[model samples]
Structures are given as structure tokens and as C-alpha cells.
Target: MATNKPQTSRQQKHLAVLIDADNAPAAIVEGLFEEIAKYGIASVKRIYGDWTQPNLGGWKKVLLDHSIQPMQQFAYTKGKNATDSSLIIDAMDLLYTRRFDGFCLVSSDSDFTRLAVRLREEGLTVYGFGEQKTPKPFVSACDKFIYTEILRADAVEPAPEPATAPVNGASQEAKPATAPVKAQKVPVDFIAKVLDDIADDEDDWVQLGAVGSNISKLSPAFDPRLYGFKKLSELIKAQPKRFELEARGSNTTGGKDLYVRNRKPGK
Candidate 1:
């Protein structure tokens, strides 16, 4: 029997999904692409790991099916893991070439926390995907942090059941737990921590562009989809209670620009 499925609309934007096979769960590999396809076209798909290892045997099928190039990292040192470094080096090379619009870093290790930061320094969008156990340093580093568990759950049940209420007119009540509400306040503390961490390493007023840069650098798996916001600006605006916005002079082209800064809750 023929089945109808929603057409996957092609996106104009281009993205790359870089997987650290050592640290990322193989089960979510398909789900990861499904999620990335929502943002843009996956023009590039690469996964880094020691392919010689028996653990990576499972990824071979996926690599062929998805046309993802497998980057093999041999053990360079006894105890030191080389996969993270190799991935970072390759990512830097890709960044300098200016090939892709965004990158998807699929790994659960904190070692990639800095790689994400570096990519953003060059002004590239990053999306991070990892398990819930991913360290705070790594979790906070990305533009967005997506727990793979959530995606796994979503895969099992794509959507929630509609709320049902009693047909009787005697003060029927709807479930409050399922109701949608306005955006939650952007965590000022979290934003401040991110700004401070990046600024401390490089002393400066922290360009608004740079803030975005740092976010992507910290987490290539971060996408605004996790927060139910289409764009970053709308997410910030939704949290006016925590963030303050400002208009700055235009660039050389004379286009108006706005900036976001973290402030005290009341200010």
C-alpha cells in the first residue's frame, strides 16, 4: 500500500554534520540528520573516529547509506585520545575555506567544548548534540544544547496526544501541564557566564557578532529548534525580562544593527 509522507522541502542554506563516533551514540545518528534537515540541507556529512576499532563497525552501514566520509584517527599516543583533535583540526580547515554555512557537532565529550568556541570565533553557526551527561562546560558552550534523549523520545512518539476533557458542562477543566506559554526568560546568569568566559580569554568589549561566534564555537549541535524559537533574536526578545537590547551604528554598508546584553533581572 502506498503511504503519504510530508515532502521534505529543500533548504537554500547549507550545513555540515560532523560526528565524533567515539563519543556520540549510534542510535541517534538517523534522528540527528532528521533534525538537521529541518534547519538546512546537509551538503556535507563527516564522522570522526578510529574506524579500525571494533566499536565503530556499526557505523559502517550508516556511513555508506548517508554518503558520509569516515575520518580515521589512529592512536597517536598511549592514553591521549586523538579523535577530538583530528576533528577540530579538520573543522578549522573547513572553516578557513568558508565552505559551509553551519556545522553539526555530534559528540558527548567535553573536549570539543573549545572546538565549538573556535568555529564561532570565525562567525559560523554551530549545533551541538550529546547525551544528558554532557558536561556543563560543553553544554553551555554551544549556541544551543540538544539532549539526544529528547530526540530519541521524540522518535518513539513524534507528538503528544491531544488533551481530552469530560463532556459534562459541570466546570470541565483542561490540563495545565500541556498548555503552551510565552518564552521563558533567557538565563541571564548563563549568558553572563558565556560572555565572561570568552571575554576573559580575549580581552575586549565582546562584539555582538562575537557573542554569536562564541556560542557556535562552544556547541556545533546547538539549534534554536530546541527552544521552540525560529531565530535567535526572537528567543532573546521572548526573554526581555532577563536580557536588554540595544541599537548600534551600522556597518560599512550602513545597515541598522541591534545587540543583546545580559543585565540584572530588574534592570
Candidate 2:
């Protein structure tokens, strides 16, 4: 049986990270690198924009701090974005080099949709990072798409609501106040379907590692952090009704290996 275990960190992927400074915010740089490190080493990190303009001033310091190469593309005409053209050209140049296993395109612009499609056609995985308002076509083109909102350095966690007091001297149940449940970015039903599709025929239980890999294959940008969970295991644990989780001891080592399966119709 094929295992869903993730490759060792040592077998790191070489990725080319190309950022569109004009469309993406500078605040996400710190978190962005942290996120990318999970997948592999970024072999090439480059940001493109018209450096002469004051609008790109925010990226100046960030570029130096992160060791990102800034490519200047001067705007030759009004109502035209030369940055996108320059990025596309450079991406093609890098793709032809055949050095990178994947390409990380950081932009909220829909114009790069074709570029992503082309890269995928050449068997290169494309990871997209953009704002929530990014076009659906652009998001769908990439192997995985991460929303930049979850990558902000100063991202605010939702505050818990204060407990309500008893009114009119009536005995109020001292119910524990709980934080408001944030709606999951990835729907439960969608996750259930993915789990069911990937479950083994002989055993319904699917290894948590395999489940995570399958999720990434199905939706590259599907991350637990997007839904407030730090790990995939935590995300699975959060939805008890839709799924069941188990930890079985490994044969080689005494450490436990987690497995998950969709809940039965009646159970």
C-alpha cells in the first residue's frame, strides 16, 4: 500500500519565489518566508515593481532584510502595468533554467493567471499567495492558493466575548463563556468528501500524513492556519461530528501515528 507520509525535510524542494510588490503588501514578507519554509528551500527570491515610484517604498526595507532581489520595471505608458510583464518574462526565463521544482507566485493580480497555467503545463507546481479578493480564475490556476490575510505579521486573533450577568435577580446558569467560533475557511463537507475519496479500500482509516498530502494535492493552499488551527491534526480534531481520529503505535518506533476517517451515516 502506498503511504501518505511526508518526505523528510532533508529532501527539500527547490522553489523560485517571485513576488509582485505592487499588488502584494510588504507586511506579509516575514510570515510568508516562515510559511514557505514548511514546503522547501526558496532557491530564488525576487520581487518586481517600479522602484522609482514612492508607492513601492514599503518594500525597500523588506527586500534588504529578506535578501530578496528587487527587479525594477519602469512604467513607460499611463494606464499600463509594466511590472506584471516584467515578472512574466523573468518567470519564463527561470522556468527554462529547470533549476526549481516549483514556483511561488505572490500576487493578487489576475493577469498572471496564464503564467501559472503555463508553468503547470511544464510540470512545475505553482503556489499562489494573494488577498481574498483575488479572482477565482487566478486562484484555480495554481496547484495551491494561500490567502495573504492569514500571512500578515500583525494578524489579530478574534477576541473572546465577555460573560453575560444575570438579569432581574433571576438565577442564571453559570455557563462558561466561550470564544465565538470562527467559520472555517475550508468547509466540513468539502473536507469529508476529500477524506472519503482518499481512504483506503481495505481499511477506511487514512493516515493523517496521507490525508494532509491528499488535501495539498487537491487544494495546494489548504492550510490549517487559514482556519485558526496550527496543524492538520488540530483541524481534524476540531470537527468531531464529520470525522474520527485514532493514534496507532508505529511498528518501527514506539511513537504514535495518527489516522483519520469520515464518520459513518448512522454513527
Candidate 3:
């Protein structure tokens, strides 16, 4: 009997990336663009801020290097954030154009929470990037939220050198080095629950891809990188006690399919 094949390739999405220069750091721009490329082609890249102010001076070189168009919104009052309003208006204008499949809203402010929700309601995916302190509502509203700290360049630590030999013909024992700290652990229980909820009952196994999708839906900021793993499969495999993985042959695609299931109790 011929087996049915599943579609594995994703359609490239067109995205409009809008940045709030006031709330985001200039250092993350390179990493931000690199991260955005993983999802789709950025057809429109724009940043909003009051260009005349000295505070936004840092963004000048970054904008030129990335070719991102700057949309100036002068502060009309003493303490009002006019940039948010301008960005929201432009986002709506772009939404009406029906040209983009998604929007990347770069800001840590909760002001964009409603905008994200509204965009998703209209069938547009929203990818949010912000600091760890970003509001939960804004993070949850996005389809996927990336912590800018992770996107920034990692600090390099120099490796310890080999111990030197003593001149008295007696070799000294090398001092034991302290182990490096581990990355924060992901919520495995929550992840397993999500997988179980979406798994097929026949075998209690879920497609790896499906599980990844559901996890993102449940927690927009759920990323494998948080656990120091480069990919979701790697992260899952690292937790052998919590899950089981199997690789099956694909019928139509001539590739292997990965299936996963939560480990049985006491197994």
C-alpha cells in the first residue's frame, strides 16, 4: 500500500518590519535583520522616531547601513510618546495595502499590544522583539516573540590556559576549573502538555513540526535557544526523561519524518 506524504516546505512570507526607535536599542539592528530573514523577505523596513532629537542620533548610521526608511514623528507635547501613534498609523496603512503576510513590531512598550492583536485578527502574523522586561500582554499577542538580549552579540569569555610545569623537576597538579553555568531550563511540563493536547490518540505521537507550531501558539517567546539548543528537536532530545522521539521514513518526500511523544509515567 502506498503511504500518503505530508507537505514539509513552508511558503515564504512577505513581512513589513516596523521599529520604534525610542524603545529599542541600536545594537540589535544587525541581529534583528538576521533574525527577520529566517521568517520572510522584509519588503518594507521603516523606523519611527523624532529625528531632530539628540537621543535618536544613534540610529542614523544604522538606518543608512540597513537602508531602513526613517519616519520622523516630532514630539508635540512635553511628555507624550508621539512615535507610537505614528507607527500604529503607518501599520494600518500598510495593512490596507494587502501586500504583506506579516508584520514585525520591534518595541518593548505595551502600547503595541493592541496593534499586534488587531493584526493577528486580520490574519497577519506578528513577530515581536523586545527586552526580557517587555509586557506579557504584548509578548503573548505576537505570533512569536524574540528576546532582544538573545539576538545581541554574545560576550566572549577567554578559555583558561594550560598550567605551567614547575622548574624544580616536580610537576604540580593542575587546579580544577569551575564548570560554566548552564542555560535556563525550559518548562518541559508545559511543553509536554501542549504536545499531548495536539497528539494523535492512535499512537499518542505528534509530528515534530506540529508540536513546534503548537508550542509557538501557546508561548510566543518559546524558543529552543533559551535552553541553549540550536533547534527544537535538539532541545526535546536533551530531555530524554520527558519525551521520546522516533524517525520514520517519508513516503512522498523521500525524507525522514520525526515523531515525538511524552514518556509514559515511571518510564
RMSD of each: 11.9, 7.8, 7.5
Off by over 4 Å in 2: 1-11, 153-186, 251-254
TM-score of each: 0.57, 0.82, 0.84
Better of 2 and 3 by lDDT: 3
Better of 1 and 3 by TM-score: 3
**lDDT per residue, candidate 1, 1-267, as tens digits?**
977874543355577788999887666776778878877888888998888889988788778887899998998988778999888888888887888777788888999889888877777777788886888887776776677755654422223556666676566576442233233334546566676676543222345666665766555444443455656666666777766666678876697576766654456
Indicate which candidate wins on lDDT: 3
Worst 10-residue lDDT window for candidate 2 reads: 175-184
Q: Cα RMSD for candidate 1?
A: 11.9
Mind giving the per-residue lDDT tens digits that candidate 2 earns over 121-224? 99988889998789989988998898887777323234434667889988877632221234356578778888889876766899888888777777766767
In order, candidate lDDTs are: 0.71, 0.84, 0.87
lDDT for residue 44 in candidate 2, whole number 0-100? 96
Best by TM-score: 3
Ranking by TM-score: 3, 2, 1
Off by over 4 Å in 3: 1-11, 154-182, 251-254
